[model samples]
Target: MTGRPTTASAVLPAALRAWLGLIAVLAALTAVVIGIQYAGHSEAGRADRWFIDPTADSVRGTWRNVALATDFWGEPAGAALLVVAAVAGCLLLRHRRGAVLVVVGAALAVVATTLVKSVVGRTIHGADNLSYPSGHTAFATALAVAVALIATGRLGLGRAAGLSLVLGAALVAGAVMGWAQVALSAHYPTDVLGGWCTALTVVPLTAWAVDRAADSRRSDRS
Candidate 1:
């Protein structure tokens, strides 16, 4: 697994900025989370009775089966740490970052989940905010994105055929876990949305930072 450069410092084009664009999308997602929380909680929000008619509540029964698929989603934080260790091993053994971004990004998702859960302090209702950031979704998306990047190449298979396969798998994995969260009533509709946002932001940041670090090492060598 040889890593390639994807940074300006590496003499690669700046098209990689698209990865950074994920940050902007994350900002918008945060705003949406706040909006939904406020809208669902405020007196004005209650008038609509959104909680009584939640998407997550309707499917709570199906979650047992879903849970089996992502029993590991609960353990994503640990898995993510394992990913980091694996990346480090790859670096040591093969001298490549290999999949550091995925591991780190997944680890970040675990952190983001804890932070949101702690700070939000919003409890779960028929389907409101008990789970603002679905760990299941976050880890699922994180692994999906990271694995895809790993499978492609240093440039991460910036090709359509390759990316589609990667993205498709990620979507399926993410969607399954996300839906499972809803079924279990562990989170709300917006909770999964927040998870997606968190994934988009953290995963790419991890990848870019990993790329930037690798590029820096190359420069030092030169």
Candidate 2:
């Protein structure tokens, strides 16, 4: 006998749920490990030294300019502009839920990083600076994850395609912003890694929560 048909009220597909669980576990675990290793520290650790060049700046000239351009999008004014544009794009695509996700996800990622930084007590440049996780990197990654999730739903993609899109977007955005932070000496390489993981951990969970809440409201009305 065949199984019952899927309905609008059905929970997330098993493949998608498993994918989310994997992403969340790995991301959160990585962030925690890095934070523990660097807690209450100001200088780059052994792992960080491998990535940082002692004698020369790795990013320079044209590449430095590119990095700066990418970095700008993570700044306060730039991030605000990005949010406005993203929200407009979501509306144009007729995805109000996606628009809300973009706004809320980005804010939560940044806030989460800030709190983690405080607890991690990691610093760079000086004692006053607390930079375990790069907030800029977190913001960029969060935006990308939101967009990817929106695309997945809008296109009605399957498990593999949706997971691929989300992971790819998150990786690209995280790398771009993380590189910028390291090149500018704004944060340690490990800090960037922490930031990337923070978004990876937060965005998917937030999206799931949003879906549940929306579905609950719809069910109530029905």
Candidate 3:
């Protein structure tokens, strides 16, 4: 006695298709950005210059001081801990499919970021540290993307209500990482860009697929 989709399932098809399209777009855009950076730095002494332009360097130093002085949620460890909490919350709420998607999206974000960074092998703007894809940025982007999906998808949140509030908090945290990295001279603008592209490209499609699967499971039992 299978039946029509539930309120949740009703929106799954269109949303899933949209998400897939978005992921493809995100991937393409990220690739293009990385390519542009590569070409930009391939010239005589350009990579060095772009990575450490004095103007940005000056601003970055000040940002790092703010992070150092406050230590208020600037640690990567704190971000990781939040990931654990997000996953736990989803599981507790019986949003298993969505939770899995969030975790997978995050893991894939890390993998993609690592591969791109390694291939670029570009150093920080002012230091020799690996900096093609800022690791802190990667974590923040991945975590934020995952949280956004949960906030707006299966968890059923309005942008101005409930989970959206939490999502906003997460966004702030994500911004903190990006700002800290840029200000502290830990990464260049391009490094943060790559991380965001990688995460945004994956999260939507992954969430959509999970939503579809969850709908199917419900249909099977009905």
Top lDDT hit: 2
lDDT score, candidate 1, position 111? 83
For model 1, what is the alpha-carbon lDDT of residue 28?
Answer: 46
Over 63-156, each residue of candidate 1 has an lDDT whose tens digit, in order, gives 5765654645457455656576656655653535554565577778768866776566545663334565666787777777666555555343
Itemize residue pairs with steric clashes in candidate 1: 153-156
Candidate 3: lDDT of 36?
54
Give the alpha carbon lDDT tens digit for every residue of 45-68 in model 2. Answer: 888889886345658899999989
Model 2 quality (TM-score): 0.90
TM-score of each: 0.69, 0.90, 0.68
Query: Per-model C-alpha lDDT, please?
Result: 0.59, 0.84, 0.58
lDDT of 2: 0.84
Best by the TM-score measure? 2
The local distance difference test score of model 1 is: 0.59
Better of 2 and 3 by lDDT: 2
Summarize candidate 3's per-residue lDDT along 125-209 as a digit string, tens digits: 4334566665566566666766655555554544345334433644565566766666666666666666666665656566556
Each candidate's clash count? 1, 0, 2
Q: lDDT score, residue 140, model 2? A: 96
